[model samples]
Target: MSNVTTINPATGDQLETYAQLSQGEAFAKVDACHDAFSQWKLRSLEDRASVINGLGKALRDNKEELAQLMTAEVGKLLKDSRDEVELCAAICDYTAANGPEELADEKRDPNNAGRGIVTYSPIGVIYGIQPWNFPAYQVIRYAIANLMTGNGVLLKHAANCTGSGLKIAEIFQQGGLPDGLFTVLVIDHDTSDEIIAHDKVRGVTLTGSDDAGRHIAEEAGKALKKTVLELGSNDAYMVLEDADIDKAVGICATARLYNNGQTCIAGKRFIVTEKVYDEFVEKYVSKFAAIKTGDPTAEDTDMGPMARDDLRKTLQQQVDKSVENGAKIACGGTIPDGPGAFYPATVLTDVAPGQPAYDDELFGPVASVIKAKDDEDAMRIANDSRYGLGGGIMSKNVDRAIELASKHFDTGMVFINTFGLADPSMPFGGVKNSGYGREHGGFGVKEFANAKAIFVGAE
Candidate 1:
């Protein structure tokens, strides 16, 4: 039998190996999940909420141990890993509290002919293909919402974080979830394709690259299944002439470097008005250079290693190509010789079109600086990208920022004067290549639900 190995990116150590399930075994698991969903969907909404609440408590109860496991598996800072667990628990809490109302039947008027009600009925099974950056949160963001909506969940997490994925399934079971309701599939890419094509799997959701999204979307579409993709982006943050340079530098620096600089919605490009370009670049470069990279378990360490050496190499190639294409490396451009997959925090200037730094998502600890003529030019430059997941604006004028976010920003979600990860109360998703469908704020629970309409005849 084939096997998948989990490695610690921080220490270059092998953690564990999981045997891949054969085709028949994989199908059996899918059948089991479908069977569980058959019974799970019959339960009352309140009963589902009770189990989801228990899951939230379970996450908190196991936060420390799970956080440490994630850090060991994915190389995220210990604190960040703990925070990720907290965010996952918060998602459970939010879904449990709001899911019933969000998925409740809505009374509707069918052209005044009769009374109509739209019921959000649970689908059978949802297969989630998640990445390793936010291990717990990625699974929780989709899995919890689906569970609350009375659907079975199947996870095919990144190979490097297999332990974290299995641990999550264990937590769900400990929280009173029924057997087979949440299953972790430690399988190969071919097996994943088979699982996606299985008749029992109802819907698919993926959080990964645009290419991966395209592949999964194609396969799922061939099966006549619905999909929700949260792909990649080279999100831009504009610093207007009226912006507070100091505050903008601080927030933008944090946004760029958060998650060891591997976030999809991270502030990769900084479009600054000419008035503040020089000052912003100076401070931003200094901030990037001052970042402390070391062991992720260290409490004072600000940055950690990339999740894998291959990922680091890809990031290095992107940086090299960008420099060859006329972008200047202002802060960090060299890969430090180390045992871990550690890349220094980097800042690039003179970033223009025709360069990877200007055109694509870096997906690492690299920031691209673009100079714009004015506020109008800044907004224009921000929209000049194919990927539009998330972006931000920093200006003292709150009204102007709101206006840009409301009408001008071409992305799905926008941040104003601050940087944030995700909020349970806010809808999170992207447009264009960044993928479609919303995740939080009550949109996720209904994504895979069947909206059945029941009409009453006049007696």
Candidate 2:
């Protein structure tokens, strides 16, 4: 068997190591989870809600320790890590309070003189393959929804944050969750594929790159299992002709560099109208250059190292290729000589089609600036990508922005005038190459549920 090591991205030091489970052990856990679901699905909605509420309380109580662990694992800023814990706690609270209604049965009209009832029934074990970006939130986002829907959860978290995944399972148990309700599988990719194909594992959910999503989806498809995929995106934030340039500059900078710019929904492409492109680029570059990068545990650090050294190298290569393809580095493109996986806040202008900066998702602290002819052209440029996860529109006219977002934006989610992440009350997912199926709000709990229709006729 292999071992998964947790390394501190901020300091380039090893923190802990976990032994991977053998094939037999992993399959046994899946069997146990399936057994738990058999019992869990019979529990009343009120009983499930009580356990979920307890999970929320436990998350709040251990917020500090979880936050610190996430920072160590993924190098996110300390404040951001804390906020992630808070978000996860809120998801627990929301799921516990609103899940029953979302999954309750509904009465439907019958055409043949019969009464019809549409019931949302629980599937069996759900397997979640999550990433390390938001260690707790990513798992909580899907796990809580599945748990609330009376499905047992199995997690195959990214190798870097193995400890975080195990810790979350511990928290769930401490919160009064029944044993085997949630299990963390410490296994490799081949083992994960086998688990997906297991008969008892009814569904699969993934949060990762497009390539990984496609592979997992293919595996799940072959097994005739349901899957929910949340992939990567080079989310665009457009600055139209009537946009507030100063405000756009500040918000755009923050959006690009948030979470050290590793977010799937972070603003990667800044599509600006030619009318205000010059001023926006000037101020945006200045703001990026002014960002402070240091230890993630520090209170005042603006940015931190990436989750791993290899990720930093990939970002550097993408930037280099973009520059070679005619994109100009405005500022902060060079990698600093350091022990940790640290890359400076980078901005690449003169961006166009065919370059990585324009064509791909740069999952790092690198921003792509694309110039458009006008507001109409800006929207066209933003929609020109293979990704449709999320995008933002910066305009002084709220009504116009809303209309554009409703009618023109091709993305699954749109931000009118701000930059943000997942909200407990809003649906979160993507379309096209960014993958399908919605999570968050009330959409997630039903993704893996079986909507069965029953009809009764008088004798």
Candidate 3:
């Protein structure tokens, strides 16, 4: 039988072991979720709310343990990890209070109207394949959204966070959930594809890479199942000439280093106007340098180790290749020789197109600073990427910022001053290669709902 191993990315130590479900076991899980969906879907909206609300309370009650596990497993800073747990709780509350209203329909064409009601029915089990970066948030975003819509979930979490994945199942289970409401399949990718192809899996959602999203979306498509994919991102952080230099630099620094720069929306490409480029660079570099990097578990530690040894290597190679392509290092560039998987917060300046870091999602603390001659060049650079996820723009003139932000940014979510945000009420998804389908918000609820339109006889 195949086994799942949990390894500490920071210490490179083996933590525990879990067995991958056999073919029969995997099918059994699918069948269990399928069977439970029949009853789960029939339950009142309030019953669904109760379990989801319970999950939020459990997260708080066990905040210390859950957050610690996430930090140890995936290298998230302790405070941020705790915040994620709370956010998961908040999402639970958000959906419970708003889900019924969102799912309910309104009447239209009432003056000469026939009986017309648009109803949302629950689809079958939804298969979710989540990433490790923001374990709790990534899973909960999909979890609460889908479950509230009456769809069971079969999650195949990242290999590194399999332990946390199992614990997540425990949270729902202990909170008085049905057996098949949400099941974490302990298996690798080979088994994952099989799970997605299962007849009981009516739809799918994934938050990973462009490649993985494409692969899963393709497989689900082949099965005629619906898919919601949140893929890779190359988020841009821009500074215009009339920007708030201090506020801009400070927020940019925090966004970049949050989660040790392991975030998908971390400002990988920083485009600053030439008029204020030097000033932004100076303050941004000093702020980046001051960030404390050490044990993620330590309260004082502002940063943590990279998620895994391979991620450290992958980010390092991208930096080296960018330099070879003529990008200049403005700040820390080299990986310090050490036992832990730690890399210094690096910054590269004068980065042009055709370099690896220019339009790519560098899932690390490395930021590439590019200078634009004018507003035209700035927009050109920002809109260059096919991955439109989210971005940060800095300008004291909010009007100009919004104008440039709308015209320039190719991303789905644009923050005038900050970048790292995905609220439950906001519609979160990307354009182009960043993948499709919305999570959270009203649109997110419909992703798993089967909208039934009824037409009455009209004369």
Candidate lDDT values, in order: 0.94, 0.94, 0.85
Candidate closer to the true structure by lDDT (higher is better), 1 or 3: 1
Write one digit per residue (lDDT tens) for candidate 1, span 1-459. Answer: 688898898989999989988988888999999999999999988899999999999999999999999999889999999999999999989898999999888999897557899999998999999999998999999999899888999999999999999999999889999999999988889989999999999999999999999999999999999999999999999999999999999999999999999998899999999999999999999999999998999999999999999999999999999999999999988999969999999999999999999899999999999999999999999999999899999999999899999999999889999985899999999999999988999999989899998988765
Clashes of 3: 0
Model 2, residue 287: distance off in Å is: 0.4
| Per-residue lDDT value at 439 in model 1 | 95
lDDT of 2 by residue, 30-57 (tens): 9999999999999988789889999999
lDDT tens string, model 3, 129-170?
Answer: 999998888998998888889888888888888888888888
Assess every candidate by TM-score: 0.99, 0.99, 0.97
Compared with the true structure, the alpha-carbon lDDT of candidate 1 equals 0.94
Candidates in order: C-alpha RMSD to true structure: 0.9, 0.8, 1.6
Worst 10 residues of 3 by lDDT: 106-115
Query: At residue 126, what lDDT does model 3 achieve?
Result: 92
